[model samples]
Target: MPRRCATRNDLMKPGYVYIMTNKNNTTLYVGVTSDLERRVKEHKSKKDPKSFTARYNLNKLVYHEAHQMIGDAIAREKQLKAGNRAKKMALIESINPEWQDLIIGDE
Candidate 1:
C-alpha cells in the first residue's frame, strides 16, 4: 500500500512553540515541544552540552505560543527560524519589551 500524507487535522497532539535567548538577549533559539515546561527545564539544565541552546546559554524563555496540534507548533517554529533576526527580535519585543524570561523562578 502507498503511504499517505498526514493532514493538519491528523496531527492533534497539543504542543508549544517557544523562543529562548541568552541572559544578554544576544542570541535566539526557536523550538517546538509537546511539553514546554519539561523542555525548558532540559535547556536550563543543559541536558545536551553540545546543543545550540546549551552552547549559547539560551535558557531564558523570552516568548512562547501554544497550538492545538504539535504539527502546527512545528510549522510555526520553522517559520520563526527561517525569519531574520530583526523579525524575531520584533516579535519578542511585542510580547516582552525587556526580553525578560517568561519562565522565571524555575531556576
Candidate 2:
C-alpha cells in the first residue's frame, strides 16, 4: 500500500508523500498519495467508510512530498514508515523543523 501528496502541480499524481501529526504533535504518521489535500480532508472529516485515521483522530497535516511516479513515492514512504519514531522525527526535522502542517495551502 502507498500514498500521495499535494505539492502544487503534483497534487493529483502518484509518487507524492505526506506526514500527519496529532493534536499534541507527538504522534506522527507518514503517508504518500496522489491527492494529498483530498485525502487529508477525508481523514479530517472521517469521510472514508473505514479508516485508520478516523479511528485515531490523526487528521492534522504535518508534512508532504510530491512525485512524478507512484513507485518512487511508495519506496520512500515504505522506508520512512518502516523506521522508528526517532527516524521519522529526524526526517521531518531535516525538512520541516517548525513542524507546521504544510497542508495549510489548501485550507
Candidate 3:
C-alpha cells in the first residue's frame, strides 16, 4: 500500500445553507457557506459592522442544511430568499419549532 496525498479537488467541502435570526426573531437571513461554523462565528462577531446581519442583530443560527457542493447550497439559498416569510418560518419551524439558536446548542 502507498500513502496518498490529498489534492484541492480531494478536499471538496460540503456547502451549507443556513438561516439566522435576531433574539426577538423579528428578522430573518438566509445565507450559504462552505464553513458553517466559521460563517456563524463571523455573524456573531459582526465581521462587517454595516452588513445586514450585523444591522439586524441576526446572529443566532436557527436552521441549516448541508449539500454536496457550493453550487447546490447557493441554489438553495436563493430559493429560500425568494420565499415568503411565512414559508421560511414554516421551513425553520419544521426542524426548529422553538426557533432556537442552533450554534449555541440551546434547545
Candidate 4:
C-alpha cells in the first residue's frame, strides 16, 4: 500500500448550517449556505433589507457546522428551524457558550 496525499479538489465540497442571532440573543435564524462567509456578510450588510433576518437584526453568527453534502446541510437547517428555542439555544451553547459572533474573519 502507498500513502496518498489529499488535494484541494479531492476534498469534499463543504456546505454549512449556521445560526445567526440578534445582539441580545433575543432572536435566532438558521440557514444553510455553500459559502458561509458570503452569506454571513450578506446578513450583516442587510443585503435584503426587507428580509426577516434584516428586520430582526439577526447578523451575529453564533454557531455553525460543516457538512460534506448540501442536502445534509439543508436538512440540518430545517431541523434547527423546526426545533424550539431551548433546543436551539442548547445547540449554540454546546459550541459557543458565550454566543460569540463566529463570522468574524470568516470573510
Judging by TM-score against the true structure, name the best candidate.
1
The runs of at least 3 residues in candidate 4 whose Cα sits more than 4 Å from the true structure, single-residue gaps closed, are: 1-13, 105-107
lDDT for each residue of candidate 3 in 3-104, tens digit (9 for 90 to 100): 676456634657899999999999999999889998999989988999999999998999999999777787899999999999999999999999999897
Per-residue lDDT tens digits of candidate 4, residues 1-107? 69676455534557899999999999988998879999999999898999989999998999999999777787788988889999999999999999999878532
Q: On residues 14-84, what C-alpha lDDT tens digit does candidate 1 reach at each position?
A: 99999999988898899998899999999999989999999999889999999999998989999999999
lDDT for model 1, please: 0.91
Cα deviation of 31, candidate 1, in Å: 0.4
Comparing 1 and 4 on lDDT, the stronger one: 1
Model 2 scores what on Cα lDDT? 0.75
Clashing residue pairs found in predicted model 2: 3-32, 3-33, 4-32, 4-33, 4-34, 5-33
Provide TM-scores for the models: 0.87, 0.76, 0.85, 0.84
User: Per lDDT, what order, best first?
Assistant: 1, 3, 4, 2
| Cand. 2 TM to true fold | 0.76
Every candidate's lDDT: 0.91, 0.75, 0.89, 0.87
Root-mean-square deviation per candidate: 4.5, 5.9, 7.2, 8.8
Ranking by TM-score: 1, 3, 4, 2
- With a 3 Å backbone cut-off (N, CA, C), the pairs that clash in candidate 3 are none
Model 2 agreement with the true structure over 1-107: per-residue lDDT tens digits: 57655465553356678888877777777888767778888777877647677666777777777778777787889988899998888877888888876665433
